[model samples]
Target chain A: MGGDFGPQVTVPASVQALLQYPELKVILFGDQSAITSQLSLLNQLQHPRLSIVHCEHVIANETRPSQALRSSQGTSMRMALDSVSDGQADACVSAGNTGALMALSRYTLKQLPGVDRPALVTAIPTNTDNKTWLLDLGANVSCDADTLFQFAVMGAVLAEQENSASPRVALLNIGEEEIKGNDLVKRCAEMLANSPDINYIGYLEGNELYSGRADVIVCDGFVGNVSLKTSEGVANLFIDSIKNAISTNPLKRLVAKWLFNDLFISLKQLNPDQYNGASLLGLRGIVVKSHGSADVAAFSNAIGEAVHEVKRQIPTKISDRLEEVLLERHY
Target chain B: MGGDFGPQVTVPASVQALLQYPELKVILFGDQSAITSQLSLLNQLQHPRLSIVHCEHVIANETRPSQALRSSQGTSMRMALDSVSDGQADACVSAGNTGALMALSRYTLKQLPGVDRPALVTAIPTNTDNKTWLLDLGANVSCDADTLFQFAVMGAVLAEQENSASPRVALLNIGEEEIKGNDLVKRCAEMLANSPDINYIGYLEGNELYSGRADVIVCDGFVGNVSLKTSEGVANLFIDSIKNAISTNPLKRLVAKWLFNDLFISLKQLNPDQYNGASLLGLRGIVVKSHGSADVAAFSNAIGEAVHEVKRQIPTKISDRLEEVLLERHY
Candidate 1:
């Protein structure tokens, strides 16, 4: 009972995930009636791998994170987190309010031993086949140099998991020069440069973000969030402009039937649905947050991401790596 | 002597502007020989409105802003700005390094009264016919609440000149709420809301940037620069993906010959060239900064923007409006 669509979208997505992964088991936490109605509609009311926990309350998207934290008992988001905390579930996925989810996850799951704060990390589609892992995507609005250094480690760990190698880490700054950004960014850059264990590739400008120059790009949440959202906005504008171009011309419309099908095939790499889930890293338990407005395919992608993290033991890897890095620095 | 193409791009652009505006006089401040060669190629070397001032130095793009200011006496960028300050020219336009240009502009033409620092403001192409004015695009790395509030006023002033109305000014943040954003942003939002002189909208997310929701959007330079560049990156990615799609199908290419022309015709409003110039506002004189990689048409657009600002007396307007608004609040 989260996100804009509530059970209508999540139920089908859960069913899809169950079908995709033979060993996957899903626990749906929401109002039993709403969950059952959708389950019955899809004839999955009694699926063997699927279970339902009747949740009494749901968190509204408008609720303040601070307020949500105090009164989160029995809420679907909290109960789901509790299930993870109690070791019943390997990971939890939600499409609820971002701030509330972050707050609840941080409070309930707690931070890893060497981690200062949990960061929201997501893979952004690049111009090439490879995806760039961008971190601190609205998890913390502002971060100090130490926190940013920690984020770089976490981001590189995630990228290493995906790429199966020493990932190239780059600091997101206004300019590539050593003297370009604010003191906070400069200090963070210095820390990354001094770290021998990390493959720090110096600074990257925002324009080169999708150039596939770095495996992991790190920045504070404010800049990362704005950059991520701004990319989406530009993509939307381009799509709208193209669609308008196709619609306005009658001849183009006739050609678009064949052309658009091929175009979508080529443009599939740039689709947002495939990159739906943004995992909250640095926490003890895995929590993958889906977009609030995710559709069925998008929500299914989030579930897949949680499944991937569970198998990879991402939280454990992050904890071990952070400890190793901190120990190497004699911290 | 500035930008990628230097006189190769600027000379033709100056000739175009002189042709477009008969009253406009252009002083070319660079190597006199290089300026004459380009002017002679265009056969505008002896044009009545065209003149050249030989400059002894050029600032490399890699030069730090601090170092650029120290030796900027006879540099092309500085000379052009000095012309504006000495009343030889009403406005200055450059496609030099952004940091160098900002430092020189601030040093040569002092800030307006009541303005803490100058901000870079530019019009972004929107989904509708109207454009959005975004400010503080890499002028200052970070800004306080008072500086952001002043940016809002300056941005609105520029937007009003374009729209001829009370432009709706919105603060760019991760979310739209009283509680959202960092302390500085929240405090600035309060300032905008409290001021009766500003038509302040609540807040704008990055995804709504091109939706034309607000005429003027304000943010600190760091966030603003990243957002602006991120949008460009996304646009480039989209164009590349579409071009790749078009190239893969030979039959589609034949259809694209006609369809592409029509498509470009419809997509003209979204073109970057028309919106190339980013003005440095809240200064004692008008200074327009062109894209460093700008072509002739794009450079001409920057000159056109400078001409418009000169005619409107944008700096004077900003100073007067800022004083009036500041006086009203007893600041």
Candidate 2:
């Protein structure tokens, strides 16, 4: 049962992430009578950290990520990526079908050793005291220069696990001129300007991807999904041209409902449902994904980004910092 | 001579496009004593439809478009592309060095015979009912699929001269899938889905490039200059985060100046200085470019888009509809 309000928005966003994580556990995987009739209209259907597991096949938001990674095996998005590849789920969230949740989360949890393919990462909201991250947001729609130097070292170790001591890094490029792009973004900005243990920074255009001057940008998943869906289509054409210019002046809709309730309370601090999840970075366990038109508060912020990448064991910290920066560039 | 407000914003934007075109005539071409000392500080220093032409070999916004078309021969952006290739200028606006004005306007007015290289177009504002041309906004940075089927027949003959009766066209693709991109955008969306003489409209994503539903759009030139500088860096981060959340409340900046005055008058109708010029399309004379940090009313709307593509002759309607669609595809 993939997105577009699937179990009426993933069963009340998995019973509100099992009532905000008191050691959360949800195992839903799909259509056991349409997720138990949306978890029997949610009075937390007998909720001892919830459970469902019935999944009799579903996956089609027009399937085809190489034919749903070889025929979506018993699909509730491949049994929620086979319950996080069988070790009884540390993390798995979907909203589903972003190319069948990135080809069944890279064919049921694979890729982590000094990672070669898994990239899609996200997070952009910027003015800065943290939030830039980007990556191969569409997952390898033609990358190179060593998979954009391993998507700038897994977007600088996921922005240095947000504690951010020295993040920066860049390379989305179309001019910050080392003779601007092509020839594979000038050989991925000459391998992030000769690595030097990666605080790189040489280039970043597409209008400085939310100008929080780089805490890992990188590109190549079709220019990071066209610079993250052209900044969500210019913030949905500036909130539909300010609600069609305040519904054409019935005294500017009574002063635009106190100016769109003080601009949607500071645009709910740049909310795409409070930045719903994306991760799928160099994979080997955690899956995240979300936005297949996510709702119920953006699939409970993609189950609070798979419980913050399973309490920060973000795939053993990107497989121990991509095996110590690929054995110190012995690549 | 070339942007960053050269001659204090192109000599008061060529004296406000010769006071809004009474058959306008300009010709200043740089350093005629820093443009007659900025038209002797704009007291209209002898402005009989203006003329200056002093040119002292300049071109240096970090040169190299093959060394600025071989030593920027007689500079002022090469005598304004040799005064539109000797027809003494019907069109040629510049904000300098867009790869040295597409290599001296393709080494002086060349291409346009079933054109090969020269796309960098513009015009984006779109909630439709106009605006959305796009193109190789950075000029040929790795294109192929027959240069994106000749940028979808020169962006559907410049969106059918912006009247757009049958324009729709498309291609930009990072997924509005027909097997989403790469493989040169699926062999240029199978030559605009078997051509029927252009109105293509298949793949579109990058959030439907301002969801004003495709009136041409095309791609390449590094994903059309990262989808036109990521929609000018998401309209400069939504006008610097709604002016830092309406300046942290002194009664919310006196109720955010009457609710940001009808959302900045419908965001000044999606202004980037009212879409300041760009059009370098399949050459044969008509240049445009602007915005190297444009400012005198956005270089008088890039000299009113080079007097609206020299009064819409637009290189005799794109060399007679690209020589009747390249002789009805006999290429």
Best by lDDT: 1
Q: Write the per-residue lDDT of candidate 2 for residues B123-238, one digit (tens) a residue.
A: 78888678788888777778788877877787777777775658888877786242378888888787678778888878888877877788877888787787678777777667
Q: Over the stretch A1-331, how does candidate 1's per-residue lDDT look in tens digits?
A: 6999999999999999999988899999999999999999999988999999999999999998898998999999999999999999989999999999999999999999988889999998888767899988888888999899999999988888876488999988885242378888899989989888899998888888999999999998888888888888877787787788789778788888777776766566575445899999999999999998999999999999999999889988888888888898886
* Shift in Å, residue A282, candidate 1: 0.8
Model 1 agreement with the true structure over B164-272: per-residue lDDT tens digits: 5899999999862323788888999999999999999978988889889999999998898888888777777777777777898788888887787766665555655
Candidate 1 at residue A26, lDDT? 98
Q: TM-scores for all candidates?
A: 0.98, 0.37
Report RMSD (Å) for each prediction in the order shown: 1.5, 21.7
Clashing residue pairs in candidate 2 are none
Q: Write the per-residue lDDT of candidate 2 for residues A94-182, one digit (tens) a residue.
A: 87778768777887888888677888887877766778888887778887788788878877877887838668888777762423778
- In candidate 2 the C-alpha lDDT for residue B193 amounts to 82
